[model samples]
Target chain A: MGRQYEIPIGAQHISLLEPLHFKFTTENEKIVATEANVYYVHRGIEQACCSKFKFRQVSFVVGRVCGLCSISHTTAYSQVAEKLLKIEIPLRAKYLRMLVIELDRIHSHLLCLSHVAENSGFEALFMKTMQYREFSMELLEAVCGNRIQYDFSIVGGVARDLKPQVAQSILERLKKFIPQLDELMDIYKNNWTLSLKNKGAGAITKEDAMRLNVVGPFARAAGLAIDVRNETEDLLPWKQVGFEMITETSGDVYARNMVRLRELYVSIRIIENIINGLPESALITETKAFPDGEATVRLEAPRGELFYYAKGNKTQILERLKIKAPTFSNVAAMAEAFTGNEYGSAPAIIASYDPCLSCTAR
Target chain B: MNKVMTSIENLKKDIGDFYKPELHHFMVMNAVEVGDQIEVQWFFSDYAHPCDTTCFYTLVRPETEIPSIKDIVASAWVAEAELVDLMNIKVENTQKGFVLEPDFESGPLRKKK
Candidate 1:
């Protein structure tokens, strides 16, 4: 038997973007086992949303769960809250929500791609990706008036209506972005340097992904074909906004990068469709009703499926609130995929997973 | 979207019969307190149809040892460990602090008495 050594990385590490710790047991250069401790950032947000916040205020509170997927969290909460009240939002509000979500996906996927590039020792490509990502952040600022916590979604509907100028600007910027996205797709798909560091380094099989019940790009990359957007039509009308499922068969770091890269094309398409056919109506639904029953929502966050469950008893405060971030579901598989891989490529693999720990730990 | 109320004893067979990885994707395990009991629900989605959902739930006392569905669904381990750590629920082969530190005084979501 080869000598085994246990190596621990981060509750804080240079390569780890989140406050998560992983302990890997290695024999020579290959990992044999892995353990993860990822709750260092847990802030009891769920409890706060239930006890400290009113039904109307909980939408903004849940928005803080993860900066990257702030829109997803708030939108899901609003949808569940809408369900509890038994009222539907305006078609205009639904279209605006879809617009911001696709924009958020663009920046989020690029950020993940940039981190993956940086972790793989390709600093130049990382820089290039980040430069391309800035446009989405600026667009978000114009639309929602904030960069991190858009607060775009409120209880009954969206907080702001899309101005014609802003809509036109969005289309213009996205038109310019298409060529940039195509450029990124070519580099991610054909780049020899990235392939060496990522191609087969960290891999999980389709059966393993299904067994683990993985979601989002992690599941899609493994050929699972699971996306909340592809499933539910009762909420935001994802199909009408041109939402499409993107998947890759490899289930490795390389395949994950490709999935994120290719999905940006779909995101761009959704944004264009939303802008081109946005309906005109009231922004907020103005419900005087209190949430009186149980409701659950499943949303496609940048990383994976974000689930929210809430219960109310005709009171201002919710009875219970649960936020299940995508990373939490993948935590088991995160550990499982590390086994039998060279420890040197761990950083890139971790980045490819695109974890949002604050969302999970909340 | 349909929800069924079941118990810990039937958790395995109920979920085992319902879950086929190729056909269904297990979603999540959710918990909420109602009166003196905790209501826990298991969620699953059909892959082919995508819109068809099956949820199996149970209401139990706070101390009940809920059976883990890890054997039936591999990813149930995280959900099981999370319920133990945050909701203070008891489940087989799962430990607390999977999401919270072990020394924390109480489960974060446990209702204050």
Candidate 2:
């Protein structure tokens, strides 16, 4: 047997946006096993939602779970609370919700792509991707008044209405973004350095992916064909909004990037449809009733499926609030990916998973 | 959603019969603290029809040892570990401090009187 050594890569690292610690046991240059510690940023939001916040206020609080996919957290929590209240929001509200979520998905995926580039040692590509990513950020700030952690979603409906001028500006921005996204996709597909570094690295077979219960773009990359947007038609008219599930077969870092790049186009299309067919109605419903039962909600966040469970008792505070973030489910798969790979490729592999440790810890 | 209530003893058999990798995708394993017992639910869904969920739930005392589903679903280890640190529920084969620091003694998610 070859001599084995251990390398510890960060509870803090240059490549990670959020804190996650990994201890890899390497035989020579290849990783034989990996152990991940992901709860460095837990803030006890679940306990706070049940003990401190009211049913209505919990939506805004849950949005702080992760800045990248705050909308997913709030949307999932609100849907559960809405279920307990037995209220169907206005059609306009649903369209508005869909619009912002698609916007969030675009920005999140772009950030992950940029980080992948940076970790792959392509600094210029990283800068270019980040430069284009700002457009989505600007659009989000224009619509929600804040770039990150935007408190745009409320229990019964949205907090603010999308004015005509704002919708026009968003459409114009999206049109300009399409060609740039196309160029980025071309660069990612044709770049030799990126493909060599990532093409077959950290790959998981379809059977292993299913055994590990992987979700989100990572699973889809491995030919899992599991997307909550395609499944949950009753929650939102994703079909009417031009939603499509993009999948790739290889399940490597490169395939994962390809999946994200294609999904950006899908998200852009969904946003355009929402803006075109936006209905006119009240932003919120008039309901003062308290929550009195339990409900569960699932939504497709950028990373994967986000799950929320809420229990209420006609009181100001909730009885329990459970949030199972996408990264939480993908942790095992992340560790599995680390095994049977070279230690040099660790950063890129972890980045390819696009883990949000804050979301997992919460 | 289809719900199947089973005891800790019958969990392995029930899950073995219900879970088919080609048919059902394991979604999540969730634990909630009820009045005197903890409710643990194992959720699985079909990829073709996402709304169709098959849930296996069992209620046990906080001190009762629950069986681990890692043999059935490998990804369940993460959630099972979290339950040990958060809800203080004992599972058959899970390590502590997966989330909470080793120096910390109390489960953050436990209800305080």
Candidate 3:
């Protein structure tokens, strides 16, 4: 090693959104080793869910874990809680849950792509992407009556019915977004400047991804055919609503961006199908019984597979609640993938990984 | 989900026999405090099969030294470290000041009488 140096970033940094720290050991601008700390924002939510919140109300509490994938947390908790209660929600409720989830995924992916552009020193592209992303946020606000913490998903089912006018507006907006998405796809796929910075940066192989138990787009970009949506058709009817797995082979930042962009097309199709084939049924399955057994639920959050485990004693409070976020699984791969990249490219690479520390540290 | 109970000694053999990275994806290592002992469960998902989950667990005291499975499963370190900090799980060579503050003497997850 020629003139090795230890460089520390975050716990607080401009490029990072959450309090995640990484100490990179670099030699001549190439990262040789990386140590990461992701617990800066850990807030005992699991313990609170077990002790403070009742089993029925824990869904809302878990929803606060991550702003981006709030619905994922709530929906996962609801599913696990449903299993514990041994109650089956209506088909309409399940489809609505899938609806909000796909909407959330669209915005979350766009936000990540924008950050990648921003961190890659392409501020103009970042601005352009964010401008395009506004539609999803507005749509989410219209759908759930709130922008961030949707509070849309409850224990048995969704909170509100999808009014026809709102559904019509959603279709109109989605129709408008397709052209914009296509434009973005073209830019991200063909732009020479972006390709130069992201084509080979932060690449991980399929074998390494599988070894590290990587999930979501990061693993999908590396050619790993792993998705909770693909596996769990019992909980949510993803396939009935036209769910398709999107993958890219390169496993680099560029490929990741491509995967996210293309997945938006899939999301759009799912949303349309959900609206067109919108089932007519009760929004929730009311349960007077308390949760009474151990249950595990796996959901495909925007980032990756979000796992929730809960145990109940036929009482109001849950005996135990454990949440394993997507970023937790990606931590090893994140550190390993940084080994051969330049120090300056760290921000873009980190953004591309889409490290969700709030979810991880919780 | 199929759950099997294993001892500390047989844990390695059980994991070795059941786990193949290509076939089964290791999901998470979860620990829940049962009455007095801690119930540590290792969860895995079938990559080839549809919605099949295998869970292997061991009941041990908080002070018992748990073997690190990082060598067998590369991604075990993170969850192993989390259990160390949150549940006072005695996994050898794993750091504790993760998911909790460094000065905490005991895990917060341990129920108080």
- TM-score (0 to 1) for chain A, all models? 0.99, 0.98, 0.99
Model 2 regions more than 4 Å off:
none
Give each candidate's fraction of reference contacts reproduced: 0.84, 0.78, 0.76
Per-model RMSD to reference: 1.1, 1.2, 0.8
lDDT of 2 by residue, A42-84 (tens): 7999999988888889999999999999988888888888898
lDDT of 3 by residue, A1-362 (tens): 69999999997899898789999999999999999888898888998998888887888899999999999999999999999999999999999999999999999999999999999999989999999999999989999999999988899989999999999999999999999999999989999998888999999999999889999999999999999999898999999988899999999999999999999999999999999999899999987999987999999999999999999998899999999999999998999999899999999999999999989988
Sliding window of 10 residues with minimal summed lDDT for model 1 chain A: A303-312
Using lDDT, rank the candidates from best to worst. 3, 1, 2
Inter-residue clash pairs, candidate 3:
none
lDDT of each: 0.89, 0.88, 0.92
TM-score of 3: 0.99
Q: Which one wins on TM-score?
A: 3
State the displacement of the C-alpha of residue A344, model 3, in Å, after optimal TM-score superposition. 1.2
Cα displacement (Å) at residue A289, model 3: 0.6
Candidate 3 chain A: worst 10 consecutive residues by lDDT?
A: A50-59
Please identify which of the two predictions, 1 or 3, would achieve the higher DockQ against the true structure: 3
Residue A226's lDDT within candidate 3 is: 91
The Cα error of candidate 2 at residue A299, in Å, is 0.2
